[model samples]
Target: MQAPEFLAAHAAEAERAIAQVLDDRASVVPERLLEAMRYSLMAGGKRVRPALVRECYRACGGVDDARVLPAMMAIEAIHTYSLIHDDLPCMDDDDVRRGSPTCHRRFDEATAVLAADALQALAFELLASADIEAELRCELIRRLALAAGCQGMVGGQMMDMQAEDGSGIDLMQVERIHLHKTGALLCWCCEAGALLAGAGSDQLDACSRYGKAVGLLFQIADDILDATASSETLGKSAGKDAAQHKATYVSVLGLVPARELAAEMLELAIAAGSTLGEGGQPLNTLAQYIMGRDR
Candidate 1:
């Protein structure tokens, strides 16, 4: 199937699965927190991570089933939660997300913060509650927790916050921050997908490499978009990164070089996906789409 059609079909399914999971009641019974969780969880984005997970699963020869959907939804919930917290007053402080008002801006800051935190906890809860083998469930939960916690996205956010002043920052440092902040969850998505699909070590490693390359490629493209895209097209504030002096590929390597680097990474990602033969086409198209996206 063509990439666009394949992604469109599966992305719709993924959205429905995610909605079903998010609508389930949590054991804690906090209605307000649940509302906040649902608010951001359903806010909507490309749903790339979950799609990657499902693609990775298919690449590993796993049949799509209830189990796979839950895992995919769990990853997206974690990702959505991260975005909510990242947009808080203490973090990015942006007023818009996905072309709509940010969570903190729509609902007070306190509610947004609580929602982000609750969503994080809910992610693990869903993982643990998945109707899969206990060992597999534990593995997935542990991996996601690690990816979303200090060693991964959170650490990257801290680095971004500290680097905002643009003091003593370099290309290597910026890449390091992005690799952790953005790349970690992406890596986990592929890994979890492969694992759920019963992939062996070799396939898992290949998917991991592709995820890392694509993750960085996605960030570099975002930097490019920030530099060139209009707010109306981007659906969010453009030029915020440069305005805030955030360390980015464009900031360190310049626009031409940043675009070059993104292209290079896209090639690497495509090559990695090719290793999976026919099963990797979705991954290949995803890379191409990432590179070609205008916003």
Candidate 2:
């Protein structure tokens, strides 16, 4: 299937699964809190991360969504939690997200924070209770914890906050920040899929290489979009990086150079995916889509 079609199909599945997960918890979760969580979680985007889990699983010979859907739901939940916290007053302070009022704006700051916390906990629960074997489930939980914790996304976020308007920053430093902040979770999505499928070492390595390249490629495209796209186009605040003097590919390498680098990363990702033969085509096409995405 084509990348767009594949993403759309898997995104639909992920949406349904997410809604069911939330609905299952409706009785126990506070009404207002559940409403707040649903507000942000249902706010739609491309669902790229979950789709990656499915694609990587399929690419590695996994035949069933049952093997990977838990990972998909877990990643999306983690992603949604991150977005909620990232939009908090102390963070990006953005009023808009996915073309709607941000969680903190639509709800109160406390509600948004609690909603994010609940989602984070829920993500772990999904992984821990996944129908897979105990050892595999443990591995997934460990990897996800590492990806979401101080060593990964959180550390990257701290670096990003500290690098704002700071002088003497370099390209390597900016890449380090992005690798953690945004790339870590993306890389995990790919790795999780491969693991869920019981892929061979060669396939796993290919997935890892593709994940790393695509992860950086994704952030570079985001930087370009933030620099060049409009708020309506992005469905959120644009040009905030420049406004806040945040370190980014465009900031460190200039717009044209950053775009060139994105192209390079795309090629690198494609090359890695190519090693997987037919199963890797979707990954390659997804890389192209990411490079060309305006938002």
- In terms of TM-score, the best-performing candidate is 2
lDDT of 2 by residue, 165-282 (tens): 5967899999999899989999999999999999999999988898899999999999999999999988998999999888889988999999999999999999989898899899
Q: Name the top lDDT candidate.
A: 2
Model 2: C-alpha RMSD to truth? Answer: 1.4
TM-score for all models, in order of appearance: 0.95, 0.98
Summarize candidate 1's per-residue lDDT along 226-272 as a digit string, tens digits: 99999988889999988898888998999999999998999999999
Clashes of each: 0, 0
Q: Give residue 179's error in model 2 in angstroms.
A: 0.6
List ranges where model 1 is wrong by over 4 Å.
Answer: 1-3, 26-31
